[model samples]
Target: MIPVPTGARVWLATGYTDMRRGFPWLALQVQEVLRKGPLSGHLFVFRGRRSDLVKMIWHDGQGACLFTKRLERGRFIWPSVAGEAVTISPAQLSYLLSGIDWRNPARKPASDAGRIAAFTV
Candidate 1:
């Protein structure tokens, strides 16, 4: 996981994004469409049209960093397109990267009762 600063905010861009574009274009999108400064030290996340790919951009004061992730089995969970963007906690970003449902992250039942018992000991 990237080490986000203590007060840094994560912003998710609503709708699909063209993954082909790099950080330069994405930074432009954040400034023009989202109406936020790209270099404001906040993380901006974008999901591709296919929903399997996700890209994130952040300006960490000294430089700009771009990160991307692709899921082999499932798509990344994204918010409905009700607005230009939505802010999520860093913990939710971790869940989103893991291809888990960030909205409702309930624990799943253990696959083996014995395994659970063994770990509890």
Candidate 2:
């Protein structure tokens, strides 16, 4: 998980963005298109047109950071609202990154008789 500041807010840019854009251009979009300060310490996330990739930009006071993620199977869920941006919590971002439905996460059963779960590094 990202070490986001406790008070920092996350904003999802509505619609899709060009994934080829770098930090400077994305920062410009955050300023001119979203009407938000790129250096405000808030994190701004943008999804690619294909919906499988996402780009994030944040100013961590000391320097600018650009993060990108691509799903191996499912596409990242997005809002269809006709707005410039939407605000979400850091927890929701984590859920979204994990390919889960951040909008309404369903409960899973505690007992898994047929399946086995394991983690390896």
Candidate 3:
């Protein structure tokens, strides 16, 4: 698992982003559109319109890092709203990348009756 430093924020850019955009362009989106600095050491995540691809950009004091993930089967779960930013924990991010719904994760080991509650991802 990727470790997240204490107090570091993970920002998810709601809706879709153009996957063709590289660091500089995506950084610009973070700064201008998200109203946040790209080099601010905070994690910024972007998802493509197809919902199967996601790109993450972050500055780790040394340099910028970009991570991309694409699902071979199901599409990535995303917020339905547009033009908004949501903050998530590193653990939730891990769940999201695992192709599981990060919002209402499955409750394990106790009962077989499956019930889920909706929450923002």
Candidate 4:
């Protein structure tokens, strides 16, 4: 899990992005396109054109860190249109990274309701 600073926000860049871009390019996007400073310490998430991979960039005081995740069996959920970033909670980010639908983070039971674990019961 990526640790979020005290009150820093997570901004998801809407639409698809070219994953070929590196830190410098992505950072510039944060400033020019997203209209936010890359060094502001806010987490920025960008999805690839195929929606199966995503890149996250954030400044961790000393320097910037870039993290990437690709799903093997499912595509990452993302908004359709472009423009304006989406702010999501850290918990939602966790859901997203785990290949779950972050837009509506929910867990589905792995077994029948009648077979509930004795401990959970």
Candidate 3 has which clashing residue pairs, if any?
none
> What TM-score does prediction 4 earn?
0.88
lDDT of 4 by residue, 5-120 (tens): 88999999998889999899999999999999999999999999888999999999999899999999898888776877899989889888988888887766777765856665
lDDT of each: 0.93, 0.92, 0.88, 0.91
| Model 3 agreement with the true structure over 1-121: per-residue lDDT tens digits | 5566788899899988999999999999999899999998888999998899999999988898899999999987777778989998898899888888998889668554565757898
Which lDDT tens digits does candidate 1 get at residues 1-121? 9888999999999999999999999999999999999999999999999999999999999999999999999898899874589999999999999999999998987677547453453
After superposition, the stretches of candidate 2 with alpha carbons farther than 4 Å from their true spots are 110-121
Off by over 4 Å in 1: 113-121
Query: Where is the poorest 10-residue window by lDDT in model 3?
Result: 108-117
lDDT of each residue in 1-121, candidate 2, tens digit only:
7777989999999898989999999999999989999999999999999899999999999999999999999999999874589999999999989989999978788778758979799
Question: Candidate 3 regions off by >4 Å?
Answer: 108-121
- For all candidates, the clash counts are 0, 0, 0, 0
Error of 2 at 19 (Å): 0.2
Highest-lDDT candidate: 1
